[model samples]
Target chain A: MKAAAAARIMPALVWAAAALALWQSGAWLLQQRGVALASSKLPYPYLVAVALFRNAGSLLAEAAVTLLNACEGFLLGAAAGVALALFMSLSATMERIAAPYAVASQMVPILGLAPIVYAIFRDENTARVLIAGYISFFPVALHTLRGLQSVRQEDRDLLHVLACGRAASYRVLRLPAALPGMFTGLKAAAPLAVTGAILVELMGAQRGIGVLMLRHLYYGPTHAALFWCTVLLAAALGIAAYGITAALENTLLPWSRTSGRRQGRGLR
Target chain B: MSMPYSTSSARSGKEASGKVEAERASGVSEHVAVLVTVEATAEGALKGDGEAGAADAARQYGAADPTAEAEAGVELGAAAGAEVGAEASDASAAADDRNRTRTSPKAAPAEKGRFMQQGTAAWALPLGAGLALAAIWQAGLIHAVLGLAAYQLPLPSAIFRAAADNAGLLFRSAGYTLLEAAAGIAAGTLLGWLAAAMAAAMPRWGSGALLLAASLGAVPIVALAPIMNLWLGDGLASRAAVAAAATLAPMAIGSYRGLTSADSASMDLMNVLGAGAVPAFFKLRLPSSLPAMLTAFKISTAGGLIAAMVSEFFYSSRGLGYLLSNSVKIARMPLGWACIGAAAAAGIGMYMLVQAAERRLLLWHPEFRRRLS
Candidate 1:
C-alpha cells in the first residue's frame, strides 16, 4: 500500500524536478541569447533558493501579513456563509427568496466588487480583508446551504422521534452532515482569499506579500531572485491555506476519505 | 441526558409559544425537498454553463428520496420543520407566521409528487424580500446602520441614473471583459481536456500528472496576473492568460473525473472486447465525461470571468474591471455601481447561454431532461 502511494507520488515529483532543471537551464540559455527579463522572471532555481535564504526575515514578515488577512477573511467568511445558509435552511420562503439573489450576487466577479469596496473603505488593509472575506464567503455560503438542505430526512426524523430538540438535531444531524459540503466551500475559499489579498495589495498596501511582489516587480533584474522568491512565498501561503483546510477535512470527516480505507485493508 | 435535552428543546418548545406557526417541513417532505432542489437549480444557473449537471448529480443521487423509505416515520417529521423555523430570528419568524396564517388551511398534502403545483409558486415572497431589501438600500437604512455615507452606498436610483448616463461606456467595458473570458474559457477548457485525456489514458503516471494539474487550483488568479502581465504585456492576452490559468484546474479535474468515472461494468466489457486503453477512452469514457466536462464549464465560466477582471486590476486600459476601479479612484460611486450592474448582466447572460447549451446537448441525460416538461 505504501509502495502504491509512493508510486502515485513519484511521477509528479519527477516531473517537478525536471521542470525545475529545465527552468534553471532555460534561463541560462535565455541569458546567453541576451533576452530581457529572463533572469528576472525566470531566474535560475538555485538563485531563488539563495534569495529565500537571504531574505528570510523580510519575506516571513510580509508572508505573515498576507496569510493573516487570508486566515481572518476565511474565518469570517465561513462564519457569515454558515449564518446565511442557516437562514436559507430555516424557511422555504427564505431559501426561495434568497437563493437566487445569493447565486446572482456571487456570479458578479469579486474583482469587480473589490474596487467598489476599496473606494468605500479608503483603507487598503481594510479593503484587502473585505476583498478576501468577500471571495471566501460565497463558496462557504453556497456549500453550507447545499449541505444543510441535503441533510437526510431520516436523521432529522430520528431526532424528532428521539425528542432531541432542534438544537440537538442541528448539532448532531445537520451540522455534521453538512461538514463535507462545508469543507468543499472552505477548500474553494482558501486559495481565493490569497488571491484577493494579493489583488487589493496591488491597489495599495504598506505590508504583505502582495506589496512585496509589486515592489520586487520593479526592482530591476538585479533583484530578480528576490522577486521570484516573493512569488514563491505568495504561492506557498495559498497552498498552505488550502492544504490546511484539506487536512482538516481529511481528519474530521473520516467517512469521506476515499483512499485511506478502501486501498488499505490488505489490498496489495 | 434526556431531561437536559428536553429542557433545551426549541423543537418541543415551539407549541409552548401559544402562537400558531406552520411547520416548515411538513408531511409534504417532497414539497420542502422540491424547494431546495429548484433553488439549487437556480443557484447553479448563476454560474457558468454546464457545471450544475455534475454537482446536482451528486446532490440528488446522494440524497435518496426520503418519503420512499420513511413513509410511516414521515409523519413524525412534523416536529423537524418547526425546529428550524423556530430558530432565533425575529425577521424570518415573523415572515413564516404571515405565510402560515394565509395558506395553512388550503395547502394540500399531495401524495403524488407534483412539486410544481403549489410549492414552486412561492417565489413571490422572496421576490418581495428582494424588493424590500432594495427599498431599504434606497432609503439609506444600511447607511444609517453602518454609518457609511452616500458615496460609499449609492442608492439604486442613483446607480440606475449613473448606468443610464454612462450606458455606452459600461456596456463596452462589459463586452470587452466578456470577450476575454469567452476566449480564455475556450482555450483553457481545450488545454485542460487534453491534459485530462493524457492522464486518463495512461494510469501509470496519470494520478501524479492529474495531481499536479489539480494543484494549479491552489494558485490564485492574483499570483498569476502580474506575471502574465509581465510575460504577455498589458493587453487582452494577459487577462485571457490569467483567465485560462484560473479556469484550467477545474476543467482538468472535471474532465479527469468524467473520463475515469466510467462504470466498472462497462470498463470490464471493454476489456473483454480486448479494447486498448485509448480505444476504450474514445468508445466509452469520452461520452461518459460530457456531464463532468459541462460541470467543469459551469464552474470555470464564473472563474474565467473573474480571472480576466482580476488580471486587469494592474495593467489594463479597458474592461469593466479597469473602469470599476478607475471610477472608484475618482470618487464616482454611482459609476462604480453601474459597472457592478453591467458585470452582473454579463454574468447572468453567460450563465443563461451555457444553461441553454447544456439543455440542448445533454437532452438524453436524465438530470438535464428533468427540467424539461
Candidate 2:
C-alpha cells in the first residue's frame, strides 16, 4: 500500500491499541480502589467477554427478532412514503389536505408514540413493527416528496409532450427521477428503524435486542458490566446496519455520487 | 443538447401547437387551454410573486368554488394589468439598455419562461401525491382504518392539547435542557474547531489527537453516558459532558474538512504573499470554513439534545429525559408524551435557531439565495 493508505490504516490500529490500554488501566484502577461491591462481576474486559459468550444464544435470537422488525418496518414505511409522494405530486388539492398531517407526523417523536402503539397492538411483534414503521415512515415520506419534487422541468415537459398518461408518466419519469432521493431516505430510515424497535422494546416488549439490554441491566450479575456489554452489542449492530445500507445506496445509485459530492462541498 | 427549442417565439408556437393537439385528440376546446393558462398565471402571480408562493398556489388552485374558472380569468387579467403598469414605468430604463445592447427583448422573457418551467417541473409529483393523500384522509377512510391505532398514536388534537396543558412544566424543563444543549454545543464546537485547526496547521501529532477524538466521538451514547455519569456525577454536568462528547466528533470532522479542504490555489497564493500561518488561516481558511462549521453546529445541536436525554436516563434528575423515564415507569402516558413534546419542540427550536443564524451569516451564499428566491 501507498504511504498515504498506510497512514490512514494506522489510525484504526492505534485506536484499537489505545482502547485496549485504556481498558487495562481502568481495570487496574478499579482494583486499586478496591471497589468490590459486586464480587461476582469479573474485571472490565473479562466481564465483557463473559457476558458476550454467556448470552450469545439469547443475544442472537433477540438480535434476529429486532433486525426482522426493523426490516419489515423499513420496507412498509418506504412503500407508504413513495405512495404518498406520488399521490401528492398528482393533485394540488390532495397536497393541501395532506400538508398538515405530514407536518404533524414529522414532529411527533416515536419514543412517545411507541407505548400507545404497544397498548393498541397488544401483540409484542405487531407492536414492535408498528413502532418501527412509525419511526421509519417520516424520513422516507419527506425525502421521497423532496426527491419527486426535484425532477428537472425539462424531463416533465418532455413527458407531457409525449402525451403520457399519469401512470405512464410516473413509471417512466418520476420513479427513476426519485431513486436517489428515495435511497437517501432509505439510508436515513435504516438507523431510525432500529432505534424505533429498540425504543418499543424499551417501553414494553418480551423479546428483542432492547429487551435483552434491559434484562442485562436489571437481572445481570453486575449493572455496569452488563450495561457496557449491551451497549457494545447495540453499537456493533447499528454500525453494521448502517454499513449495509450505505453499500446498497452506492450500488443502486452510482449517478448520485456526483450530486452527493457537490452537496458535500456545498455544505462546506 | 442544442438548446433543443429556440428561445424566441418558442412559447407562442408551443402553446398553439399544444392547444391544437388537445383539440384534435381529446376533443377539448382551445378555450380550456386559455382558461387553464389564465388561471395558472393568476395563481402563479399571487403565489409565486412572494416567499410563500407555493402555499398561495395551494390555496388558489385548491379552492372549490363553482365560479373558479371565471374567477381565475378575472384574476389573471388583474395580475396582467398590474404587470403592465410596472413594465410601463420601466420602459425608459429598458430603452436606454436597448440602445446600449443588441440582445432581443424576447430573449429575457423566454429565459424567464424556461426558468419557471423548471420550477414547476419538479413540483408536480409532490403536489400530486399530497393531493391524493388528502383525498384518502378526507374521505375518513384512514381515520376508520387507523382510528383505534390513531388514538393510541394520539390524534394531532390530543398531542396539541397535551402540549398546551403542560405548557409551563414543559417550557421550564425545555429551557433547562436547552441551556445544557447550548453550553455543550458551544464548548464542543470550540474544542473541536481548535483541534481541527491545530491538526491542519501542524499535521504530524495534532492529526493523531484529532483521530483519537473522532473515534471517541463515534462511541455510542449508551456506552458513553454511564461512564460520563460515573465521572461527572448525576447532575447537569454529566448530561452536558455526554452532549459535548457526542457533538465533538462531527464538529472536529466538519471543521477539519473545512480547514484542510481549502482551495490549493488560495493556499499557494497565501504562501506566495509570504503570509504567516495564523494570518493565512484567519484570512483564507477560517472564513471559507465558517459555513461548514455552521452546518456542523446545526448537526451537533440535534446530537446534543439526544445525548443530554440519553445521559439523563442514567444520570441527572431534572431534564426532559429524566421526566420522560419517570413518567414511563409509572405509565403516566400523557405526561411522558408531554415530555416528548417538550424535547421535540426544543430540538426543532434549536435547529431553527441554527438555520436562522446560518441564513444571517451566509446571506451571500448561493444556497441561501436560492432558498429565498
Candidate 3:
C-alpha cells in the first residue's frame, strides 16, 4: 500500500513541477512583450509562492473562518439530505413525490442563486451557510435515495422471513448499503460547500479569503502576487474540504474503497 | 470482465432504478445520462401501468405471490450494493431463479413497461408537489411562515410577470451565456479527451496526470474566474476560459477511466490477433468508453454552464449571472428571480440535449440495450 501511494505521488510531483515551469515561462513571455498588467495577468510562480509564505498567518485565519462556515453548512445539508432520503424511502408514494424535484434541482444552477441568497439573508455568515446547505441538499438526497432504492427485493424478503421489522431492515441492511452512495454525495458536497462560503464572501462579505481576494484584486498589479495567493488559498480550501471528506469516507466505509474509486461524480 | 453489477436476464418491471444505479456506479457517471434515460424508460412503463389500474395489479399480485415481492427486493439489493466480483454473478443467478418464474414472456413487456413508467410517473407527484408549493408561495404563505417580506421573496406571479416584462433581455442574455458555455464545453471536452488519450498511451506517467486533472476538479470556479478575467480580459474569452477550466477535469478523469477500463480479456484477444495499440484503442477502448464519455459530457454540460454564469458574476457586461447579481444588488428581487428561472431553464434544456446525444450514441451499450429488452 505504501509503495502504491508512492507510485501515485511520484507523478503528481512531477506534474506539479511541470505545471509550475510552464506557468513561469508563460508569465515571462507575457512580461517580455510588456502586455498590460502582465504580472497581474499571470504572476510568476516563485513570486506567488513568496506571497503565499508571507501571508500565511492572515490567510490561515481568513481560511479558517470560511472553512468553519462551510463545515457547519455541510453538516446541516448532509443531515437534511439523509433525513429526506430516509423519509422518501418509507413509501413509494413519498419517493414518487420528492424524487423528480430532487433530480431537477441538480440540473438547476444552484450556485447562480448565491448572490440572491446573500441579498436575502444580508448576513454573510448566515447566507454562506444557507447557500451551502441548499446547494448540498439535493445531491445528498438524490444519491441517498438512489442508494436506499438499490436495496434488493430478496434481501428485504430474507429479513421479512426472519421477522425483521422496518427499523431492523433499515439498520441492518439498508443503511449499510447506502454508505457507498451517501459518501459519494458527501464527497461531492464538501467542495461545493466551501465554494458557497467563498462565493458569499466574494459578494461583499466582511471577512474570509474571498474578501481578501477582492480587496487585493481591486488594487490591481501591485497586489497581483497577493491576489494570486488568495485565489490559490480559496482553491486550497476547496481541495482540503474534498480531501477531508474523502479521508473520512475512507476511514468510515473502508468497504466502499473500490466502489468509490470506480466513479468520479463531477462537481456542479 | 469486471462487470460489477450483473445484468439480470429476467429484470422485473420494478428494477429500473436498481439497474440504473448498478450501471451508474459500476463505471460511467452518477448523474446525467443514467437518470435521463431511466426517465423516458420509466415513463413508457408507467403510462402502460396507469392504463391497467396499478392498484388492481398490486392487489392481485400482492396476494397471489408473496415471493414475487421478495424476489424484486433481491434484484434491487444485488444491483444497489455494488457488491462486485464473484458474488455479483451468484446474486444474479439467485435473482434469476427467483424472478424467472414471475415475469412470463407474454406479460413481460407490459409489466416491464409498467415498472419503467413507475420511474416516469414518479415525476407526476413531484410536479403536483411543486404546484402546491408554488401556490403556497404565490399566496404569501412561505413569506408569512419565514417572517419575510414580499420585497425580499417575490411572489411567483411577480417573478413570472418580471420574466415576461424582460423576456427580450433575458432571452438575449441567456443566449450569450449559453454560447460561452457551449464553446467552452466543446473546447474543454476536446482537450480533456486528448489528455486522457495521452495518459492512456503512457502508463507510467498517465495516472499522475489524471490525478492532477482530478484535483483540478476540486478548485473553485470563483478562483478560476478572476484569473481568467485577468489573463483574457472581461470578454467572452474570460468566461469561456472559466467554463473550460471548470469542465476539463471531469472529462479527463472520465475518459481516462473509460479508456483504461477496457477488460483484459479484450486486450488479450487483440494481442492474439496481432492488433497494434492504435488499432486496439480505436476499435475497442474508444467504443467501450462512450458511456463514460457521454456521462462526463452530461456533467460537463451542466457544469460548464454554471461555471460560465459564476464567472459572469465577476466581470461580464451581460449574461444571466451578471443580470442576476446586478438586479439583486439594486434590490430588483423580481428581475433577479426571473434571471434565476431562466438560467435554470437553460441548464435543464442543455442537460436534455446531452441526454438526447447519449441516447443517440449509446444504443449498443448493454445498459441502454436492456432498456429495449
Compare the candidates by TM-score and give the number of the best one: 3
Q: For candidate 2, write residues A79-129 as lDDT tens digits.
A: 887788777767755665564455445545555566566666668788777
| TM-score list, all predictions | 0.72, 0.61, 0.73
- Interface root-mean-square deviation of model 1 in angstroms is 4.7
True contacts kept of each: 0.39, 0.13, 0.45
RMSD of each: 15.9, 12.7, 14.6
Better of 2 and 3 by lDDT: 3
The whole-model C-alpha lDDT of candidate 3 against the native structure comes to 0.71
DockQ of 2: 0.11
Among all windows of ten consecutive residues in candidate 3 chain B, which has the lowest summed lDDT? B1-10
lDDT of candidate 3 at residue A133, scale 0 to 100: 83
Off by over 4 Å in 1: A1-5, A82-92, A109-112, A115-126, A143-178, A257-268, B1-127, B258-293, B359-373
Error of 2 at B95 (Å): 31
lDDT tens string, model 3, A156-255? 8899999999999999999998886687667667877887788778777899988998899889889999998988888788778877887777667756
Residues A53-109, model 1: lDDT tens digits: 988998999889989987887788788888988988776667767766765686666
Writing each residue's lDDT as its tens digit, candidate 2 over B215-274 gives 456455655665665566677777787788868866875687667657789999999999
